[model samples]
Target: MARSLLPAPDARGPFSPGFWRSPLRGTWFTSVLGVVLLAGVTVLFVTGLLSYAAYNPDLSPVNDKTPDKGILGFYLFSWPTDPPWLYRLTQGVHVTLGLALVPVLLAKLWSVVPRLFTLPPARSLTHALERISLLLLVGGALFEFVTGILNVQLDYVFPGSFYPLHFYGAWVFFGAFLAHAVLKAPVAFRNLRRMREGGEERADGQADELAAPRPDPPTVSRRGALGLVGGGSLLLLATSAGRSFDGPLRQTAVLTPHGGPEPGGGPNGFQINKTAAYAGIRADETGEEAWRLAVTGRSGTVRLSRADLLGLPLHSAALPIACVEGWSTSDQWWRGVRLRDLAALVGHDGPVDVFVESLQRRGAFRHAALRANQVGDPRSLLALSVNGEELTPDHGHPARIIVPAAPGVLNTKWVARLTFGAL
Candidate 1:
């Protein structure tokens, strides 16, 4: 047999080919995991982009989180308001699938870790480039996954804002991910085909750098290893996917922060991301005698009290509140005045962008801007009540904004003003 260029087994540490003792450490195993991630991460990237666009990031200085997105924003479009549950489904899949893929990602990394300690690091220019790409692929994956999990849990301990950090990190990570996938896809497919044709031993025989010179005795078959990874993924999915739903299934979402019985109870009880007190809502301000809504447009500013808003034509819609954090509420009976009606009162007779302001004293998204499509949706409302009861102080007592297919934060609790026109 031709002598391998890699260091002999007598060498110490990971630089020795014999140091990697797992019989499972071979090209076929790594290739299989790579193929699965190639398809999964692609879907994850696309849905993540869709989630960003749903925020109307084009509304600069208002709803835009990554203000300097530049060319990255090229694919952004006015997110549709139809289907009503569009954002809910996309974001739900994005978060849930992301968590479920953790085991596969970790296993893929383990299968290829020996490469990181290769002696001499690079044998040629092509080899050097491949090593560099691999480094970026691994580092970027870790950063994106860690930061994303923390964000979903509402942990902001990391440096920089979550929006911009995650946005830019995704672009860099996916760029390297695509490059690596393109370079290795042909070999991976070949390995998969060899295994499928009962040529598994032949495929293992042709193992490249991933094969250990002196592997340990096999404790489990390759198929068994894959089964273990898949089982772990399914376990995570069962515990995390329920946060996006309602009823008993929600209890299964023990992995999520908002999972378990609904917070509090009764008609007014559902889920409140931030309470009125937490938002600095004073008792005197939200009271019917004190609260007033300011509507502005071509007709100029017109202030209306809560009673006056009630006197206007009332409408109702069953809408859900879906947050970027991945937790969502079931459809609740919401009663209030239509956003279009409010726009008309301010002289905007047709679909036009609207800027919404809230009385929130702390935190991000105290105000938000909605696109014309969102404003045109007749289901959008300045909700004054839910489940047929008056709004609780925590639920935006006087009124709140509820736009179909919009993010939960953009719903703008404790709404104080509505400006109908180009945002």
Candidate 2:
């Protein structure tokens, strides 16, 4: 047959097999990284979904950041309050593991980067499909990791609201990730099995394109490269994991935001995501005389002043404030009327969904909703004080909602009104 009209496959630059010379760039090395990612990423995705459900996203319009989430949110459930530290654990793992896996993810990409430049892009229909999946997997992983780290650092340089973008991005990324994993898992497991069975080297006789045809002398052995990647992950874990704990370990959280000592000095002093000043809370509005909490429900509306709320039966619970940003306080001694009591004031003595409005004039979460379970949990409170001291303005002076196992924002600060019953 005569030569076709199509351009010859570009083999220059990265497309040339010679351009990749890393001796460690082989299927076994790549597969090992993939296997690690398979386990780690699965946990990350599950914890992430749990974090979303903890927001009670089913509340819709108010708590549902991804209203257009459609079938993606099918896994969401009424988040439980029994553990009290449930959200804390899930979110902490999500953020910390995501950070620690960065090194591994990078190494994995480096090992496979040559594939991105492969000439004659596809050899068959299946090859083309696999290529597409690979593209999405890499792109999705980078996008998710970068955006996640930015959020953890409290950096909002990225455009648009983080909630929807991250939420939707996760679904797309996970879809591609699962597809790629399904196709490659057998090869990865086989490579791992071979390594375990004492055939790590000089075993695979297959034509491995990942191996450089003219590789330079190895600077480090394959085992050394894996060690380097693992060590980097450990280093990251050491620097970032402490943000989830309280006390000296917190100092080790050098890479995470708000990992330092509690801001200011006192019982009430702890990490505050936003200050009253930042949230646009005027001194006059939150002052005892001016701030009256409006409670509306089956009994219609009734207003209560700070003193009035104080006069009602008071209770206390030790709960931590965990943020999506990853940092969390130790269990704080929180004192106030139980959320069920507040709901009771509105004639909702039983479990009932509650919509909470905040005095915050600027920023998201000025208002939030809690599922009936959250509202009814005996531990949930409209916190008036923390650690036996009245709340600081930054900690939601007049009043704040502190629900066990809820995301920090949903624990609406500077609370203004409570509406019980359906939204």
Q: Which residue pairs clash in candidate 2?
A: none
> In angstroms, how far off is 44's CA in candidate 1?
0.9
Best by TM-score: 2
Would you estimate the TM-scores of all the predictions? 0.95, 0.96
Residue by residue across 1-423, what tens digits does model 2's lDDT show? Answer: 111234356567777889888888988889889989999999999999998888888885778778888889888888998798888899999989998899999999999887777657676788778788777788889889988998877788777888887878888899999898887899788877876786654366667757888998999999899999999999999988888877788888875688756577778667888999999999999887899999999999999999999999999999999998777888999999998988888788778998899989887789898989888889999999999899999999989999998999999998889999987
Steric overlap count per candidate: 0, 0
Candidate 1 lDDT at 235 equals 96
Tell me the whole-model lDDT of each prediction, alpha carbons only.
0.86, 0.86
Candidate 1 deviant stretches above 4 angstroms: 1-11
Residue 147 shift from truth in candidate 2, angstroms: 0.8
lDDT computed for candidate 1: 0.86
